[model samples]
Target: MTVSRVTLLLGLLLPLSAHAAEFDGAALGAVWALPFAGMLLSIALWPLIAPHVWHMHYGKITAVWALAFLLPFAGRFGLATAGAGVVHALLAEYLPFIILLTALYTVAGGIVIRGNLHGSPRTNTTLLAIGTALASVMGTTGASMLMIRPLLRANDNRRHRTHVVVFFIFLVSNVGGSLTPLGDPPLFLGFLQGVGFFWTAEHLWAKTVFMSVALLAIFYAIDRYWYAKEDLLPVDPTPDTPAFGVDGRGNIALMLAISGCVLMSGLWQPGIAWDVFGTKVALPQLARDLALLAIAGASLQFTPRALHAANQFSWAPLKEVAKLFLGIFATIIPVIAMLRAGADGPFAAVVDLVTSPTGEPLPAMYFWATGVLSAFLDNAPTYLVFFNLAGGDAQHLMTALAPVLVGISAGSVFMGAMTYIGNAPNLMVATIALNAGVKMPAFFGYLAWSCAVLLPLFAVVTWVWMR
Candidate 1:
């Protein structure tokens, strides 16, 4: 929002766009994907291998990758083409995505849940369930920010509680957000791309419910086993208060207002759009973005400072997301164009993998392809790639090819639990746990837990639903 920040955003993002030039993916080779590949690899590997360096210089690291793509792209295609792509990605995709997230984070961070409950197996399960349901409403980032501290406080007395945080990531951070755009970034990208606001809830609710219930049951059983092990601290770190309640409850109404803005944008298009660098910025989208910023400002103005202190609220997570995704949205421009090219593009093998020999689409393969990629890469752009690959027609995807959309949506949202880097909140929750003195697992250790638990369940989902 500051001038320097705007300059930095434009400086990094300027390489991705081309003025009025629709990129032909069939003309591009696989080498164009390296910057994107490097960006993702840095995100996945850096924190694990060099935590201090990553923490200190992640913005510089992202800038390096963005330049890596943009410099070459400008030289090869001319500056105008590169410039247009940057504006398009920024105004069309990045601004809206980051604005909504900022609003959600700001508003949710204002609401502070007070007091703590004992972390019994039943109590922990109930808390996870509540957080899971809230994920679809407040967003994984917002819901995770609101709920994790209370959950951690509840289990501060339990000596063996790493599994508690792990299951929280599985349910509240990933799987539970499948039913709505507010629940996850991938679904939100789908919404911005003309997918109906309610389409995901209608199609993916069954899967969401099935996954939520099963994960809750599994969490209860595991938590009970851990509870029975008699791992208890002699003195509870956080004593239970006589009263339990919420502060800054007014944000609840603001959250609904935010949801209304999104829903209205989808339903009430005025067909008036301004052409900015060849991208059509519609009036509805413009109004929605402005309203979100205003709502975020209102939260900051009215929410009490005491509530913020109680929540341990900070803007670091939101800032990190904005910076990292700046590089991601920039470098991903070509990969998306190539995927859009289908069989004629360099990623023809990808096309073949998701389609059958007879040219029939296979939802099971789509599920696995999107899931596997999402598990390693950032799920939002990964969702965009596959959504575009599936013909980039929201109406058609929601109707005739509904099963394929289901596969892509479920995979991106659900299997993000497969790794810490798969979704933003997974790492945020881990960091919060670590700060609270819970010895959260290293990246691979968490991966082992997810594979043991979620992969098998996903296999069953494929057989019963996707197939």
Candidate 2:
């Protein structure tokens, strides 16, 4: 790693020495969550109501939300305490989250699938099915980035292109990532917390398959309806061309390397870790992240410029994720801490809703609670909240409390499709689609799509699997 790399890594993994204090969640009121709520609302509304302002000043807007929480937090607690909370959030939560996402985004951006099949209903569904299969192997973002351009190009000639991107976000970016920890951050956090590597695959395979098939079927039906209503443009935007094959296949090895690195981190616990402030940074985890960064860099260096050019690879998508998530991480500290505090915290009613009076776990409620929250908040942290709510014991969660785990896991991963901000890839996919000239829905419009389509399907999911 170069000096710049080291500096960047250190900035992310900032030592918690100066601010080792913890937040007093019990003392904190519900008001503390305002900044987080504001951040999410801004993300949801600004693009629809004020696209120019959002596009230009989103980072500034994010900072405003972060400060809303931070300034008050520092005043109520000491600056050290507030700063410590921030550091811990960065170290334990955001750092690994963003690093791995960045690596995946970067590596996947280098690989391009070249081909333009006519955007027939069958062809689109087949592409979605293929992307769905690839999601668990390469991640939702990876699969979406790799396949979205072609899917878009295949359908560029058609009208009513918005629904295709919407379904694409639902299947390729969210539901398809349910089967493996590598597929989504929540599952990866589960793996790091001692859930087995194949645990998610073994448990969520049925749910993943059910959702994928149902969504594909629904998409086909809807797409066929749209295909029938298709109005041709004066000039066809994308003329059907000769068959195209996979280009930059070399990045496949790099993605596998990243996956292997994650598995190794989970399995190879050598008891080596650094005490960065109050947090213990483990060697295997650190090694995995470093290896991922190197792998991403290598993929970029080795891939031909022509391939990247073809893919229209740019840092804007990653930059959007990085900026927006910083505000989320900062502002969410209080909300998550309050949730962690459970009964005494302001969200006691929320906690009450998820459990029975007899203190037994309610799998159905857990599903909706986790899923609903994940739809608005980042799913990974939302998963962590409910994981702890369900007793955070990996061994028991894997065995006796299995249903609850499945509920939390399913809700967090599956419901990330309800809106663009629900998952990292959702926003990224929407952004890419918009850049590609698909008139993607605004936040509430997208929610209308999910609410109309996904909620009924999730009811079936709850009845079949979670219930």
Candidate 3:
């Protein structure tokens, strides 16, 4: 099902003959829908093929998919500039966003610790709450990285540790990332697209409260059972270590430097010029390049050798991300192009279902659907599509639509933890966990956790806040 075919089919079926011409079959197929469709097909087929062809893990296979799809851009732009050149430019420009996210994950992962828990369940619960709160500032990835090791260390003497990590993923890795734009890239994309920076904070109170409460309750119950079991074991008196300490205070500066570079990259705006193809070409801004260079430099210079010493700072994580995202980028290019061409097609029908009597959009429904799809899609583009859709109405509707946009943005970031491919950080967390000998569940398996645990909490959030 190529994008053009889908567009042609939709064009013939739509009653709005006046708008039929908007669907450009070839362009639609090539640029809008193909990339996403390709990604789905590739993910579905990769496992069957990977063992024989590559001897790679599923993560590495995903990376390969991203790279193969993305490689064409470099080739076309460098030596054979044409239609392909334009695509290469587009993909290359977006590459830095992924790198920025990877850096965040690396820093977070480095700070985590694993030890035995000696306090009451309430004490551990308080710590988890504090850690999740920190996720908003340090990034869910950073918070997860910083805390997972400690949580694991705390439970090292116990056999009942799996549930603790599971809860951590739900609260810290996924839901906790919603409060700030810096906490999640998808929301940051919303910020770049004219959605205000503080928008989420103003609007997400209900979601934050709901997920927080539900996760805390679930953790308490689970932790109680585990605590009781631990009481049966003989207590060994080990020297009491300090609750927390800033071991590498110097590293904080490097962390800030890297973070600053990432911030500058997000704020970079390229200059636009008319091109030979009758379209605008936006040249990369100096800030964008410099920011990336600074981040790369910092990662090389500041990362402790012992920190990366165990695994040799293997390119595996980055490599895997590149591969999976390539397939995603290429596959969805055409799909998005088609969707943009026919803004009021079947998809619009879906959107219209959520509109209110006064033509006001419903924030709760929009938030849920957008968030859910973002778990599987490239949320940056997904955010753009929804933003354009919601913003396309008269300017007067902006106020009415603001909450909807916030909901979408918040939901996308929060729920991205639902699956490994939901957001970049999810995969990074998984990889780092794997490196630490904690095997994360498979794609669908992880989603089951979210569906059972997070979705109900999100429902309550939507009811209380977004409704």
Candidate 4:
């Protein structure tokens, strides 16, 4: 949207900001979730059924769905409450979320791995393993952006290389990110809620290893089968070089700085906070955001243009994410409020699924419940929902209810591979592959791949571990 429209919308909403109050979830009906469902459905179906329209007018479409909720919400509740909800979503959630993503995207895009190796089955397995290792260090977004071009270039000569990208999403984009907050948004949300920095890595390392090695093994077998068909191009599109090295190495330091900023926010608490439309804006968070913005600027200013060109980096994907997630965050306010209400609210059935007859939490049920929703909804907020449902006490969760937290974390991070829309980087990787002439599967086709390969493994995980 244009700046003028944004200004006007803020103008309308800010008048009652001082009177902002939280939504009463018990009072909200299921109908209030329509806009959230509509937004998700539009994201899923619109692209498949009407690619042209969706591509051209997704921003406008997102705006419509957002307004569909906002207008009705204003009429049902008072204008003050609606305005506060928007303010909270924007200030507390959306801004920090988008800024961090943009910073990661910019920094990672700058680091280009030049030249290529032949995409042998061994070589492919090794690359996937390296990416899986890096996912926790540099973030799934950063690692995916940095690794995808090299992987694509390596396989450009092969005819049946789409499976390579699919497995990349399964391993590097999702499961590999299970080990740290920087690796995935959901884990970061956990960090923001007081989960320790190394907590996920400590708790989830074994699970991550199991999933990553298993997927890599499966990929190797499948890739060898495809490789045996020997459908090679007479001449490779991207000829292999004697040695490959990386450009834009400075972004590595910037990434570390970004990591430091994130860690600082989690560790440094000055006991100072400001209330903006009923949202708590902490000093550390503000400082971290400003530092992140500066880091992104530094990356753009210092990185050479040729590196970005070679990477084929564009802001289009980030812009699409920013717009679509704005609608998602806006429409999801009531849904989250309802979920937060537990048994008294509209999502009582969802609450029941994770709760035992004796009112105890069920780790196995938490695993499936969080995973299934995460596959279809935004995994970050899905993580938050289950986190809250499991009693949003981070210290208690880390110690007494550690198993339940494990289920929630693993589900949010790993099951994101189940669909293109499940995680931000899943679609981003698919788009990159498609642009490089890899014929990626449609949304449902990818779903088939994930379910066939992933469900059995997840079942094993539940039986042996979570249960």
Candidate 5:
């Protein structure tokens, strides 16, 4: 993590000046991906097998996998390639990703919703709809953190509510983020890769609206069935207030600033750049990241202390994200590289799966493949891999390859609901729900819910849209 350590690792592990970009993924075998696989396995199995060890040393576990990949990588392919990759992952990819998330998390957590209404099936579904709409504005994490406690408060009296939280993940955490880059990490990555700021909203609007409307409708029917089964024994724990409204509204300005900064970075092209190690830091992007940090700081100063208290805002969730993603970003570098290498790389079979024999992009295959991998792996980089495989040209993807891009976008965002680990926000929402006294399902148990409800809806989506 230290500069000197990085210097030594890069200097000795790989050839001097050799960057990951110079490393030919085609020359590397599937064995190079073991560390990434190990990292995924660590995230998936550790918590289930040893809760104490995983909880305490998850960072260390992730670090081990990262080192596993880095040390061997340096030894095999020197600076000519891997150096570019290592620097890019850190400076360009990981740093910006984490910063934006932190900024959104900090500001959104300050805006708490107060005075919850009773949790009727209609009310719950309506709240889901609103949160889904809000996700594009606030980012999924912001909206989820803001609305989740009120949702918990509303449903505290209900005998059965896990189903409500499950649908919340489907709609708010995943599908809701489809319209904008700020809404989800994957889309934001596309923004960084030169996609237009509103490109996702432009091309993905239909699918986003479709999924949001359909999911809301399904949630309503299901919640009605579950609500009918609840008895009168459980009393609502939330203290009734005169009316429903929101507090910490000042954060709205900060949220808009966040969105504006993203848009400006895309629109204002100053073509200037800085060389930091092997990564090319563009002037506009640098300015945008600085502005984001300033906005987060301003939000902290401007928002009242009472708002943070009301929200019960804490740094624990963000810290958890920081620790886990360090390992993820590091280990995933090669996987992304190899994936970008296309049919010549170790994942050739995977490449072949999403392509027709005549070499056309199968939008449906792209959807399922991207979605399923994203369900288990980190959705953001998984999206990048497929994005590159489909040709990493933002202009081309947005125009000529629009359908393929849609399939990729819908898959990465929508199927993140399939598992708690699919998207970062899914687990956070589940955790907040649990802390608020909801008996959330176990890992696999939650997957059952997704398989039963969300998958069928996704099938419908693929049929109507992707096909």
Candidate 6:
């Protein structure tokens, strides 16, 4: 693929400019506030207008939302050129990482669930366990997509199977994704912003343990309930079964190749070796990224089409992801740009609110606010805003702030289960489930499940660990 010079130049320039000079803290804070305000306005008004003005279909509604969000980017671009003398000046470096994370998770998800079409009772339980583990590595989206199809297939003979997928979304797609940066976009953003990769892993262990236990417990109970309900229904002991087919387990190699590519792309950063558009740039981190891409490209040649056939390799899932996330990319650009321009002033009050009573440090409030906003707005930008705030001080406040940061990370990834729009994977799972004839609950209905189930567990997390 021919790389766009424009894109390459912009990539080289933006980071240089961001690092070369700092903007007014007040301006940056004000800009950051716009998105938060917009998020509130969007969520508040979406309900009233969603029923009457927008189509109920997920694709169409999400498309409209994307367009609405993009308008601000155009304005920001013009404003930045005129006044700030910069173009695409927001903290946009994380966008590619976001895309990489989304794609990696999607592919990983597809791999985990490929084999268990028409899962038996034993298979369903196994899939849940496997899917949960996959959630920590490939991400909730990756695990959810990989497992959702087989899960639906397992319950194909039953009538009360919709709830199975709902809880599946809650477990594998959202809450389970909280354990690592690989599990959620917000934390990945943290990594790019100088937050160490192992920091979240180390700090969030308690929250992860708490939530994982809670989700597993809930899933087991629900699975049992549904299992009993299945027993009451007439059994199709002799139902027609699809032919058992096997191919080279080469897809596992392919999956690993893809994952390496994604991880490298995610961790790659521009360095000072490259120069473009009057700026010097460095990107030594691209080595790992290039290697991963090379592996993926090679897999296309080395892996036979027959393996993909068994996996039911259709482009539809990736296509849907591309289409929707493109809209997301377009819409949030301006929102984030504006936030970057003026985050310090408007968000200062929010920062104060997040501080400890003695004006020392408070991580708990930081986690709660960041996590809550992450549920609606893209978590990447939310992470950036908080990171910038936290990094501003040269002093080591990690001990004080670490718990809060972990809280934020966990909350963002876990609570993404609250709505279809909460995280990319949540919607993907819903789409796949619906496509397979399982009707997911409405937005508010899903929120009710999260509140009743996830919130209590989160409280436990706060008390036991974050406090």
Looking at model 4, the pairs that clash are none
Candidate 3, position 278, lDDT: 24
- lDDT by residue (73-100, candidate 4, tens digit) is 9888877888888888887777888788
lDDT of 1 by residue, 1-467 (tens): 34386566556545444355666988999999999999999999998799999999999999899889988997887666777787788888899999999999999999988997889999999999999999999899888999999999999989888999999999999998888888899999999888999999999988999899999999999999989996689888888788999889999999999999998899997789998767899999999999999999999999999898888889999889999998999999899889989999999999999999999889999899999989998899899999999988999999999999999999999999999999999999999999999998987899899999999999989999998
- The runs of at least 3 residues in candidate 1 whose Cα sits more than 4 Å from the true structure, single-residue gaps closed, are 1-19
Residue-level lDDT of model 5, residues 126-206, one tens digit each, is 889889999998889898988888888888888788999999999888889989999999999888887787888988888
lDDT of 2 by residue, 382-437 (tens): 89878877767899999999999999999999999998888888987888889888
TM-score of each: 0.97, 0.90, 0.74, 0.96, 0.94, 0.76
Which ten-residue region of model 1 has the weakest summed lDDT?
Answer: 12-21
Worst 10 residues of 3 by lDDT: 17-26
lDDT of 6 by residue, 190-223 (tens): 6554565556667776667667667766767776
Backbone clashes, each candidate: 8, 0, 35, 0, 18, 26
Off by over 4 Å in 6: 1-22, 28-95, 102-123, 231-248, 258-272, 275-281, 299-344, 392-400
lDDT of 6 at 44: 37
Cα lDDT, all candidates: 0.91, 0.84, 0.57, 0.89, 0.84, 0.57
Give me the displacement of residue 253 in model 2, in angstroms. 0.9
The lDDT, on a scale of 0 to 1, for candidate 6 is 0.57
Q: In candidate 3, what are the lDDT values of residues 144-164, reduced to their tens digit? A: 767665565555555565567
What local lDDT score does residue 411 receive in model 5, on the 0 to 100 scale? 93
Error of 2 at 184 (Å): 2.0
Write down the lDDT that model 1 would get: 0.91
The TM-score of candidate 2 is 0.90
Question: lDDT of model 6 at residue 166?
Answer: 71
TM-score of model 5 vs. true structure = 0.94
Clashes of 3: 35
